[model samples]
Target: MSTDTQHGESSLLIQLQHGLKREQFERALHDIRAGWNRRELWMTLGLHDVRQRYRRSKLGPFWITLSMAIMVLALGLLYGQIFGQDLHDYLPFLAAGFVIWGLIASLVNDGCQSFILAEGMIRQLNAPLSIYAYRGLWSILIAFAHNIWVFLGVALWFGVDLNWNLLWVPVALLVLLLNGLWMALFLGLVSARFRDVPLIVGSVVQVLFFITPVIWKPEMLPGRALWLDLNPFYHLVEIMRAPLLGQAPALANWLPVIAITVVGWAVALFFYSAYRWRVAYWV
Candidate 1:
């Protein structure tokens, strides 16, 4: 608290700022690497978030599975009748797509709050900012872990083929998680600076749910509309859903997802490198 000590601290802070300016990208990479090294901390925090959200509820996290099962059953039955599709086929497809969609939707929606929700920690802790991104992604993955059971049950009931193609599921999930990380970094940074971003993101996600092939098959569209080809969510979901349903996702599906993942990371890393230092103040 002495004047000399205060002056020295201020000088060090200024020097740190100048260093960050000159090595912004390196600093961003360092943050990510450091965050990974502290996975135990974020993983514990993420698991704590899941448990805390369901505290005192008898069903606890199983509620995720139950709710997803109910939605899939209701939609599968109604849509099967309406579209004249076989219940056997439609239900499994719906279950798989809905489960994958749940992961993607939660990642994007929760990514918006990745930094904002950690405002106190961000301000007080001298930890890597990327930890918040990892924490948010881990929490959503926990939810997805629960939700996947719904699809497994439906697949069992429908006798959906489980073949070698199913191995692709882990790869698809890895790709999705990579996409989720960038989304958390990018969206979290932007959302920290703009309070309205979460609301806008939520609205957009809801709209995308309908437009994406969650409730309907792509072939349901006559000639497979051009827009379906362009819908990134369609490809994202297909990459996961196809494997769960015992089909290897076509190159068509993998191509768009790969392209999106690359472009998204580039954009995310650029903004994250430039503005990561400002997040503590913004949040």
Candidate 2:
């Protein structure tokens, strides 16, 4: 094309880039609403992500199950012996704790990359940022499903009681997913702008893995149980793990988790509203 023609085209593109748009809240709302309306898109993308990751592997996603099974058995036996707890009790507890921890940790770690990983698509398409967040959470949930088989097998082998309280499993999962949404939005936004945020998030999650009750029982904390009570992950894990182990989680567990979910969403919503417009540039 001629120089003038190319210059005019570039000017038009710049105008479109800076064109009139909705206010921040409306834009954020539209991003979410439009994303929800296109659930199939993100769900397919998410599942495809899982499938693609394991595409050439002989065991595919079953590798997740196998690795988790090995980790649970190894850790359960070692920790049970060290803590002098009954194998029957500790194995099932470890199984439940590992499964829940995997879900929480994966969501937080991967959620940080939701937008940055989708940079190409975000730049090329006029889609909602929430779509990328959904894809991240859905992909993690798919992997969680794969890892959960180890827990089910452990429960069955140990003959853990299948009480009606197990219904809380899905409830707890729903709460986790809700929390995942806001976390994905908030973390994804921050990580897109600050490349260091993902590194920081991964490091924090790694530290939390040891501190959280994944391999160790909270009873080890003794009179310091109040510290565990303050940990949101402890409650999240207990709500799911207690039910799976045929026990009811204390009311304190449910209350703090619910409170965190509420407050987290509010903060995420405000931050998202303020920063959603800048994501494209940041990414």
Q: How does each model score on lDDT?
A: 0.91, 0.88
| Local lDDT at 245 for model 2 | 93
TM-scores of the candidates in the order shown: 0.92, 0.90
Instruction: Show where candidate 1 strays beyond 4 Å.
Output: 1-22
The prediction achieving the highest lDDT against the true structure is: 1
Query: Which residue pairs clash in candidate 1?
Result: none
Among these predicted structures, which one has the highest TM-score? 1
What's model 1's TM-score?
Answer: 0.92
- Model 1 RMSD in Å is 5.2
In the range 1-283, model 1's lDDT, one tens digit per residue, is: 6355556647535644554564898999999999999999999999999999899999998998899999999989999999999988999999998999999999899999999999999999999999999999998999999999999998999899989999999999999999999999999988997899999999999999999998889888889799988999999999999989999779999999999999999999988887888888788
Off by over 4 Å in 2: 1-22
